[model samples]
Target: MYVQIDLDGPAGTLRVSGHGLPTVELLRSPGAAPDPLVPLGTRDPARLTLTVDGAPARIRPAKGRLSRRSYRVDAIVSGTRYRLVPCSYGESRLTRDGRPLGTLESTGDGRVDADWAPGATPLDQALGTALAAAFGTGAQPWWQTAADLAAELIP
Candidate 1:
């Protein structure tokens, strides 16, 4: 199964879809259409677009290296780079400039969980949850979505 997710940014609304839909919860957010002007190329399994932003960004392993556990994600948001590094305990950590911001984890029951560090914002939690769900899989698509959604959270 697949899911589609949408997020709001400082510039304008960003939409993530394709594969074509049903992974993310429509209960959480309704998606917007992607702009045809900017091309995302063909490497990603998911799709995203921001109303007025830089050229398309790429999702790569943190530090440009592979991991034995899972791929820790890294990307630039609004030109600011952010890393979703893995914690020693098996969850992924989203940190900027070495400051802890949030944690995203996979529950054994097929649900992905997101927990914001103290002083985190709603967007942080939402992004973390979306990141967590990017790695999730199951019969239901509620918590399992595409990496494209995770990439758009940058900025």
Candidate 2:
């Protein structure tokens, strides 16, 4: 199955479309923390709460640095775990229990293309598309980008 995720909509909105998967729209609530680091001069990190098809869902940074080579975010929906692992550039891999599920590639804009493996369920398509829309890019918050650069220079 092939899914397309558009993140360029209004702020905090994600639109997902695919052949076998039902179109899903996810909304992000303000002040939900998905990253460990808070923006500079901010008191708290921004929290991320996504509403998937009118149901609340949670996604958070699970491992690695967002600005580094390896970074991953985990989202659980419908009792299934969908892992979005970012690779070089604007590409990401979605996995479940160490099994390859799909590949998400960003177009350097805000569009992402997701190609899922055969036998993937609807839940996988929806949640994987959501995860890719949320974190499939190489972009990061300005503060986080600066911090990463500083770390590299100082190390």
Among the numbered candidates, top TM-score falls to 2
Residue lDDT tens for model 2, 4-58: 7666433555677777776666554554433323111111213455556667665
Clashing pairs in 2: 31-47, 32-46, 32-47, 32-48, 33-46, 33-47, 33-48
130 Cα displacement, candidate 2 (Å): 2.3
Superposed model 2: Cα runs more than 4 Å off: 1-6, 18-20, 31-46, 62-70, 138-155
lDDT of candidate 1 over 1-155, digit per residue (tens): 23234433222233434352312211111243433311211112243322212344434432212232244555544465556655644477777556788766653223455666787644344444444444321122222333445667878
Q: Residue 74 CA error for candidate 2 (Å)? A: 0.4
Candidate 2, after superposition: displacement of residue 140 in Å? Answer: 13
> Top lDDT: which candidate number?
2
**Residue 2 lDDT in model 2?**
67
RMSD of each: 14.1, 6.2
Q: Which ten-residue region of model 2 has the weakest summed lDDT?
A: 36-45
Question: Please, what is the whole-model Cα lDDT of each candidate in the order they appear?
Answer: 0.41, 0.59
